[model samples]
Target: MPHAVKTFRPALGAGSVLLLVVAYLVVALNARFWGVVFDTTGLAGLHGAKVVAAVAAALFALTLLMLLPLSLRWTFRPGLAVVLLLSAAAAFFIGDYGAVIDRHALASVYATDAREAGEWLSLRMLAFIAAFGALPAALLWWVRIDWRSAPRELWSRLKLSALAFALLAVAAGVAGKDVASLLRNRMELRHIANPFALLAANLSYLDHARDADRPFVRIGTDARRGDVLVPSKRPVVLVLAIGESLRAASLDLNGYTRDTDVDLHPLPIVNFGRVDSCGTNTATSLPCMFSDLGRAAYDDAEAKHRENLVDVIQRAGYEVLWIDNNTGSKGLAARAKELSAAEGADPSRCNADGCHDEVLVDRLKTLLPTIRRDTVIVVHLLGSHGPAYHARYPAGFAVFQPECRTNELQTCSDAQLRNTYDNSVLYTTHVLAEIVSLLGEPSALVNRMPIEALRCRARRGHAGAGACPEPDVSPTAAVDPGIDAAMLFVSDHGESLGENGLYLHGAPYAIAPDEQTHVPMLLWASDRFAARRRLDLDCVRRGADRPLSHDHFFHSVLALADVRTAARKPALDLFAGCAPSR
Candidate 1:
């Protein structure tokens, strides 16, 4: 009986389980992070070294993170659960769209309306939540802790923290050169830094929110319409349609070989080929475009409290209305009669995903005849917004075949992705054409002004500057003297369809790629409106190749509405030089 003494080993405690879970996440669940590191570092060629460095760095980072929970013994499990849940969500977005969860992206998530947020919900996300969040959360809840005395627990935490720090320091010292070089050369790697990336982004967003909550500064108080009045018997109706995530390169009118803009080709439209956006995201661009200040001087805090294009138009006695098929007006339509497409969306045009841009068009038909005043209608369209591009348009309009049907765009091939995106653009062309036809007479204004026009305009009065004559018309003159109606379509910003591995918009404007900044600005005017305003369609078309941007939007709209406010910078107006009411 005494021949062999059995050796007993204690089962793992809840603290050990938490540590194991953290280790598993740092190693097994961080594929996206490792992939990003490898791709960005160009370390794929050195496969063995890449794996070794990745594993070592991940373990070191995990050790440092684990110290937080270990230090707070009572909250250890709950903290782990929260971390797991956030990591799962970050993984889902990074995997789905190859998106970097930066501060701008976090802001976009916070700003997303409920309807838009639903587009990202799917079986895949649910499975991810279960595997990465719920299962671990449940395990943390059920596991039993050893529950040592407070003094002992404090000593244990101190020991663990010291150990973690020692290990991290050694690890960092070993791979410091490689890590520093990789991060330095690949700035985007910061966005792919797993849980740390998300934590940093949240902190950045909180800081921004704190700044935004400060008192808003009112701009354009001196805003008043031009003394020159446009007395039209039929009432001037100007439709400024702000398209969403629409890129100029994808449109046929802008030199894309695709038939995305086929429906619009026959119309007398002027497609401004090289127009830039104020920002690469809606939340930034929408307000910036309407503010009296141009992008260079635009401040969100100041812009929020002030009168925008709609406010000035309203003050000048024009009936201003905003019809939205996208997100809310970003506070730009605060003073206007606002309408949402969701209010009247038919089953065919809307679902859980969102209402199509056509819903606004349909509602417009009913509202057009009722308006009896000089009016400005800002139609905000949900045009080609991604990563659910396939859901944007009806099936009939999917001219491109074998489209990518899922929101996980990376799941599809390049052809499938491009085809699906083109389908959305095609749908937008139809929407634009429908609006043009509905208006009966569409006139096109293409801004062909050169970049030098902006630089030279201020110098016109200076010696040796080419004699660019300023408008000689009196303030009391009427610009559009008869029945006037026109539709102007410009994108809030452009989209990036897997360009340089970027799949969506919302990149910060300063460093944004051309794919995200260059947008389409098209104009369609009624024949009567064109004649009444003395606009030369051919001249506007000839100028279509010139450079322009959202800097022109505020002044152009004020000019078009015949508002003579001092806020209107005539030099920035696209129609400024063409149609001065002499």
Candidate 2:
């Protein structure tokens, strides 16, 4: 008889497998954590090694101890696979975009719609996940485990847990004070602690999810339409245009060297130069922007239970409408008339990636002629959101050459990123210009004005028949106005274009750079609206450089529409103290 063929099969003890996984997770999936550690501790000498070694030891022990509970015979491999996959996804964002895996960041992830999330899909991301997540998991599932009896396995796990605890104690004892100080100073490092950060974020999300069925609290219930101080026959209209990812530093109106705001150069829009966002991402900023609770007091869990700005304005008897081209209104429009531009988006303006912001202009065109009441139209734009910046605008809007079209932002050159981003900013301005021109049209106004003749009178400084000039406050320019309409544009948040190795937003708010917080805001009121409201255009211009924030948004819109409520704080309203123009 022929000798039986021998085959080799890899096998390891359960403890050995656990150790291998722990080591791999800490060392392989945590490049950002280690990089921050080395950067903060300075890898120059023995001191660096000491600090790094202590952190490594503590992290290792904590990870092993935490994971030990799930390292049983039936649960070990599956749990490990799950961890690897999650860690891989976290690592990709942390490494490539310099994003943190904190609760707010996780909230942004959870709130992201499929179209927005798909903007992040790329071959590089796929390859990274496959190499770091799926491959290891496949290998882990394939390996054979030398399992002992149940009692012996239980005792072995307990012994391993004990060992991990002892190691953790030793690590804490040796350099606890120094490590604590380091972490306190660099709190962001905590957010990059792989698996731990992910685990903590998920736990926080679950904790908040428990309140999903809680009773919804109502606010501004005393809201009612107040007597118009400067009465007019026509209805009041306020267009609240919430912009997305538009940094103040990138706009020409805010002194950007580029011509990103060229389209708005002729328009009489008040550019608030020193504006700050409440948060670095839309998930955090959107709710805070509309909530009565200011940024300092804004808690996602608490805010979800209360009514927002839209609900209050709607309750005040204004015909509130939310037209969304980005994502949904984040529950702000729960009680308002809502329209989605992306639902039946115009093919000329939309593609597989998403719809252009001009789709908003199209919606406004249809809705403009029909408004016959005091209205608050919220135009939520998908403005300059990345890393698919190139897809935001039309091909004609690609004036900036060599744009970065790929989702892999880090793969692009600095110029390409800025060019693509600037192009988007330009297109946004163009959209704003279009909206302004539309608002100035005779058909859109309640009482028809010779808007074309006015444009002609101001044509010395502008080219097109539709381009508007600066506010004509000349005594001779005064006349009785009919329609009361205005536009307020404020971004949800800002973006980071490879500044200080950060490619996207959603760093912890405390440590977020200016590029992620300093957003652009501007106001453009129709001539009649300004005149009827007795708005001191010059005074408004004088205060344009005031240090403003999202705190002003809620009260300002309310004040503009003459909505009176106990909840409205006059102190936070931007138009609070403007005297009537002479």
Top candidate, metric lDDT: 2
Candidate 2, position 322, lDDT = 92
Residue 152, candidate 1: alpha-carbon lDDT: 78
Model 2 lDDT per residue over 1-582, tens place: 999997666999998889899999999999989988888845468866777788999889878877898888778899999989888988999999898898888888889899999999999999999999999999889899999899988888888888888877776787777788889988998888998888888898778767787888899999887765333458777889999999999887776766677667667888889888999889899999999999999889888999999988888887889999988898889878888988776788998889999999888888877877778899999989899999998886676667898888888899899889988987787788777766762323211224333234323322233445544333233232334788999998899998988877998888999999999889998777877677777788898898999888888888877778999998888887783211
Candidate 1: 10-residue stretch with minimal lDDT: 442-451
Candidate 1 lDDT score relative to the true structure:
0.73
lDDT of 2 at 398: 72
Worst 10 residues of 2 by lDDT: 441-450
Q: Using TM-score as the measure, which candidate wins?
A: 2
The true-versus-predicted C-alpha distance at residue 520 of model 1, in Å, is: 1.5
Per-candidate Cα lDDT values, in order, are 0.73, 0.82
